[model samples]
Target chain A: MTKPASSHQTLNDAGEFAESIPHEKLVRSRTAQAMLWVLLIAAVLFAPALLYPVFVMQLLCFALFACAFNLLIGFTGLLSFGHAAFFGGAAYICGHAVKVWGLPPLLGILLGGVFAAALGYVVGSLAIRRQGIYFAMITLALAQIVYFLALQLPFTGGENGLQGIPRGTLFGLDLNNPLPMYYFVAAIFLAGFLIIYRTIHSPFGQVLQAIRENEPRARSLGYNVDRFKLIAFVLSASLAGVAGSTKAIVFQFASLTDAHWQMSGEVILMTLIGGMGTIFGPVVGSVVIITLQHYLADIGSWVQVVIGAIFIVSVLLFRRGVVGELARMLKISSV
Target chain B: MLKLLLAQGMLGLNNGVFYAMMSLGLAVIFGLLNVVNFAHGALYMLGAFVALILYSYVGLWFGMSGFHIGFWPALILTPIIVGGFGILIERFLLRWLYKFDPIYSLLLTFGVTLVLQGLFVNIFSASGTPYPGMPDALKGVVNLGFMMFPKFRLFAIVFSLIVCLIVWYVIERTKVGALLRAGTENPELVKAFGVNVPLMVTLTFGFGTGLAGLAGVLAAPIYSVSPLMGADLIIIIFAVVVIGGMGSIMGAVVSGIALGLIEGVTKVFYAPAANTVIFFLMVVVLLVRPSGLFGREG
Candidate 1:
């Protein structure tokens, strides 16, 4: 069966097919992409100056988190509902590592990523046992188990979480200052984004996309679909861990809020709003959502109501998402 | 020790009714729509809320604080109203997304879940208000020789079992159920046969969600009515669905109750593991049988 045109922009492409498109649109899209990158870099450099550095850091952290999530939903055709376990679980573990173990900030962050990878390996190994919606449900239930453990286990500090996490020096630069910390987070976000970009364009990524488009076809072609999916799942989880680990140090705290199912929902929202399957979608999505949250924090649950409304609208009318639609309008391969 | 075991088993059975009802509703919806109704839990919570309003707010708005809709009428009335909302959701929202990947429908229902759950939390804070509409006939305790059980809980268990049996019989043995099954297998063929496939789908969704409402009404007096009550339970139900597979009516019913009883037994030995024991079981089940115990390989 042919995939719907709106599911992802890449649905139009059938590799090794003889349909030749005009070259002008490709050049045009490339130029447009380059311009966007320049604009984004400029924004990152100047956003901290205009906005609170800490707030900018929060956006960066969530942006990276959303990107990691998009790698699954947007690229791999897997919609995991339990990403918060990696994000929040890492926050708690990284916090404990840096605070109690007195590890360097870099090492603690790495340790958090490793922990998330391991957690992802176990969760993903079982989750991949089922396909499609069952996969989503399995991940969600497993994550709920993790949340329960975080609440019940002694090290997670229960509801208060792992409080007073130190933002130790990374290469002699004290992380206490907002400016230095912002740059540090920016660096991590860039590294994570680049890794995702490279992965999506790599040979393995092509196989993932092949599986996403048609798993049976890919399997028939002698591909080991399950192993590929497990690896992709682990990759996404570790990056989410990096985002959460970085957040742990930046905020100097880890709490149940990060580990909660609501956080998982928020990441999904970010990916959907920005544009699923678009390279730059989740970054833009996270910025829009976090900014709305920052401004609307005082209105209480209304923010959630509004976000929910936005999600419903996006699903019904704008499934292409903001970046997805924009790229479609521009006839660009990338969002 | 045996008496305590029986009591816990009874309590576990009470919890199982909810699980069975919820998972059964989800399986029914998924069978036809190919959409995993993520909002099934929210709809269950809505059922309880509907019963609450009928019992309390409806009377209060009419300026009779003491006069309330009895526990009996509310039980019948709640599902119809909740089922109406389900029909509206199917007609308006769920109809548009059928041509796309099933995941989008899951996402859409998830959005609906957030909206319904968020609005309720806003109106009635997170802390649940206990339902006070239990009938006098079902209040207090009944001795079954081995243990004394709350009459309401006993009624809930029996009522749910009866409802489950009725539903199973209708689906497995009736002519209309044959149409529902035909529709699930090939809607286009069913439509060619002039069965009104879309209408069948809409009503099926309504019926499934109505079951959720019925379960909710049964649970209102047992647990405090709260917006947050459905979220956690839905995840567990999803696990039950995973373990039971989505295709089998009996599988949904049996696995849900069995897990609840297993959890109760665990609670007796080590209370801390009770909540997570089902999830671990799910993991083990997946390793042994990926398509679930009763599920055909997808």
Candidate 2:
């Protein structure tokens, strides 16, 4: 009984090492949890109509993108400046696969993830040699090379990009329809989000958090820091690819814009604005940013100006972000 | 063969001018503030626009009074104006974020880039704005027996080299340089010595930003002043900084010129793919020396 109690305590200590959030504060009542799910279901069922499906689809993609980004930043404490390479590269690959090879959408998306994962493994190895800002610059330089390659590569279709990608049928059900596609996107987003959540809560996740807090300590504890970081990078890039692939289907277009440096910056902005380490920050941030873009698309490049202002203000005044600050105030961790 | 070599050398020299000034600014800012300053390019773009506006409207009004203020005035004035603006930005935006991670400053500057770029595009309407030349003082070609070079471009090369030398001297040789270096390496100790570190940081930012503006003004006469000109050059300047390794001022100045020449030669040999060669070189540099060619391994 003492051994079991010791193990339980160790587990608790491992999970909440930094914050020491109380279990009571974390554990939601069954009724309250049920109420949350019901409200979410109602909102989905009633889904807003002015391009609601499109909006949700966009949010799903970018939320997954931010979550993927967070996998490196929050868990591994490595900030990648070239995440657009993974995201946009996968979009091109997935779009090219489905349209040119006539592969199923699921397989195509998986292939995209695989391509991005391979790239992550290679770039992550080189990037891990440096820490902090150097890592960021190295990643950015590598991503720029990828962007150049994408421009020259024939499969990417250069400047015009691979356009009119067929969404195809999902297990023989047409997802071309707006509402059905919305559900499909939501399911995928939820699945990706859950996978990330599960990863963060796993034994490996504990090791990663240890690494993030103090890598030397984790290394001393017999954890292979570099190996862990590489694997995390792969997983994050693969998930980003999943988002990019889904986005390719939703938009039926893959352009240089996807692979551009600015796209990378935009994804970073989304994650930072929403909250870096928090679970639901990406979702909220994606929703807010996407909606801003949607309504303000007519404002032209001022959108970038506005987003930049938000970035400065957010970093300077409100680094905790919307959901992050809320969770801090409530004294709970979402994931 | 000698003539062709000389021709290529001159072309490289012309490019060297742009790269030296741009990366010098980057090095200055990175050394003092530890910010990558993505807005450096945007500031350069604004400098060109300032010159254009001065040439178009200010020239017309001032010309009526027979004071022909040309590129000479812009070469001095635009930088002061833009540097003044940079001082404001440093005080208001960048100064507070100094205690935080350097990455936040990078993000803040990137935001500034977006705002500045947006304003430029809004005003300039996305097309190229051409600036007229000097009053026959330095135009046409100069023949140095082996090759003929554009006089304006040659002047630009000589002018930027002088500017780079002066900047290098200030950073490397002066007492102010010692204070700034001490502040950068360890601000707490520097502040304990009773120096106003915040003001130093702000002034350093202004100097770096003014360098960017100076490059813009010089480039306006040589190249078309377009909204996108800065974006096109910024990436190259970044490569130069990475290669130069931000630690040594001399390294920054030397590598900036070297990289510009390398890029120039690449354009001659492989014209179609010249734009991407610098980035590939960066990868190679990283693989070879991760701390960069001139950066110390810490």
Candidate 3:
């Protein structure tokens, strides 16, 4: 069980195998990265012309939310079923600050993120006490508490929700305009994506992966496992908050739906469908799901049935997810 | 006020019966499958819907005037039907998920839940449907001097208690119960003793989900049989499971009733807080004893 040398050797072997693939062949190869950048730039430039800005903005928000969720589940091996607490909780806070307190959009969003981080600290402290399945249930139960609080709180507007929030100016630019708001959301998403990328490649991320792979071994190696998990939890929650805040501004409203358990389940679906533990998986997953929802809106509740079927199929047969499968087929390992 | 309290306590105990039944299923399923059965709520809803269909449609098909199968038959039949469904789910869907991380099973069950709920919502609109109350024999309230208790509710409470006790007895005292305990502790060892562990696992899941179905049938008359009924009650039951500690049969039973009573009392004193009191208790429990009231520390 304490075969540290063999485990380390296996890790090195996998690393070598990854490295053996030529740079151009790798999924995140320089040319591939350049192509992705070009595609992203093109999408940002052309998507608004083809799609509604609000729709695009919503997709981006969910994409970022899924990515933040992936940070914990994929990298740190913590499957939280209560992420809507951060996502929806932040949305409410940001909406309240912007609409009532007259804060600028950026400040409001930041305030929401900060609040989510604090919430993460408190929730993570307690939840991290349990491992695996219990952890998921604990987060879920706590998130339900948050949901109830949202329903009861006057500021949340109860069932009606916090509606008609003004999309305040960002850096003196009126974000009420679609193009500016779209670009603003796009920029925030890019920054978030990059930050997640950086974090996963960082030393802290290395420790997290180690813990995910073997918690007991990681602990035996003298790492503070709980602290690492808590930090990852906070980071994931804060990023999720950022996505939620941006969503509140883009929509100019925050509703109880944002903080719902179903929303948490939706994020999980997005991540799982895209690729768990892969950098681009959640983005791809969110895009596919949001796009499906956009087109299938006419079907009403049938969409849920389809989504459920997808979840079952994905878990049973396509566990690697779309991007994860793509990476495997391409013979490239992606973080 | 005292009478009101007594009435609320009875209501609470009634709700507790459902909670105990649901959580018992959850604990049993979790103990063997190691999956949280996120679809437990949906299964509960399915149970009620099954009863409703059996009452309405089965009678209609049989061409009998008002031959709706009432509470008594539903109590027996709903569990069998739902438990059979559970067996199918375990055999086909959940079986494949065992090798993967427990989260995948959760996700799979969640997907199943969504599908179940969606189908029910599509069939019978989201609004609550009324199931007829107890038959003529069980109609009327009992005057207990302190307060009046509905005969149907009293029957439900007593029936659920007996069911809970029988499950406890079977799982704790009987020979099969010993095998189940052994299987839960070490399936491999149990298998070495020639016990068909996998079959036990499937049956355990069926039994657990059967309990959920029974609760649904029992709850149909008391609460409006809505598509969202199980979804609504499930989160609270999850809290109960957490408070009692998952996989603890006795813990689920005791805490389910205890929490229900607590919630009932809270409803009388402060109506607003009633919905959230159990969650608050859960948080406090976590802070004080992370493993829960009856759970052994890992």
Question: Model 3, which residues run further than 4 Å from truth?
Answer: A1-30
Chain B TM for prediction 2: 0.94
Residue pairs with colliding backbones in model 2 are none
Candidate 2 to native Cα RMSD, angstroms: 5.4
The deviation in Å at residue B110 for candidate 1 is 0.9
lDDT of 2 by residue, B1-298 (tens): 5566567767877877788888888888887787788888889998888887776777567656433457778888999988998999999998887666677787888888877877777777778877874547788989888877888888889989999999888877899988988887888999999999888988998999999999888888877888878875776787777777878888888888887777777766776566777777877877788777888653
Poorest lDDT segment (10 consecutive residues) of candidate 2 chain B: B59-68
Residue A12 miss distance in model 3 (angstroms): 12
- lDDT of each candidate versus the true structure: 0.89, 0.81, 0.88
After best superposition, candidate 3 residue B257: deviation in angstroms? 0.6
TM-score of every prediction relative to native: 0.97, 0.91, 0.95
Compute the lDDT for candidate 2: 0.81
Which clashing pairs does model 1 show? none
**Model 3, span B1-298: residue lDDT tens:** 9888988898898888889888999988887777789889998898888888888788789888688887788889999999999999999999987766788898899999989988888889899898863578777899878887888889989999999999999999999989988887788899999988989999999998899899888888777888889875778888898899975799999999999888998999999888889988999999888888888754
Worst 10 residues of 1 chain A by lDDT: A1-10
lDDT of 2 by residue, A28-116 (tens): 53344455557655555566464567877887899899989988887777878889999999999999999999988888888998999
Better of 2 and 3 by DockQ: 3
Best by DockQ: 1
Tens-place lDDT per residue, model 1, B107-215, is 8888888899989999999899888889999999999999989999999999998888888888889998888888877889999998888889999999999999999
